[model samples]
Target: MVFDASARRRLAPYRMYPYLLMTVEVPSRGITDQWRRTGLARLLAEEIALAT
Candidate 1:
């Protein structure tokens, strides 16, 4: 899913706090495959600046 400008704006304020909730949906058959192939966790960490 592509995060557009409006989505970024909406999420910007959460940057100042810790722990932002997010939901992701993936097809059952592709869940493991996608998790192993993607850098989603890393990407989210970078986006939210979660040091730990």
Candidate 2:
């Protein structure tokens, strides 16, 4: 979370067996309108690339 709670999921990269990156968008006039209520959902994905 580099920026804030707004940056929690938005600015974070998952730390796991196969690390991943993600991006999220917020709606203009819905719950996301309020930074405190942007209850985004979790997803499952496969890793395609990695660097060492």
- Model 1 has an lDDT value of 0.50
Best by lDDT: 1
Model 2 misplacement above 4 A: 13-52
What are the TM-scores, per candidate, against the unseen true structure?
Answer: 0.33, 0.19
Q: In model 2, where is the ten-residue run with the lowest total lDDT? A: 43-52
Highest-TM-score candidate: 1
Candidate 1 to truth, TM: 0.33
* Model 2, span 3-47: residue lDDT tens: 455444443344322221222323343433342232112222221
Quality of model 2 by C-alpha lDDT: 0.30
State the C-alpha lDDT per candidate. Answer: 0.50, 0.30
Please report how far candidate 2 places residue 27 from its true position, in Å. Answer: 38
With candidate 2 superimposed using the best TM-score fit, by how many Å does residue 20's alpha carbon deviate from the native? 4.4
lDDT measured at residue 28 in model 1 versus the true structure, 0 to 100: 40
- The regions of model 1 sitting more than 4 angstroms off are 1-23, 27-30, 34-38, 50-52
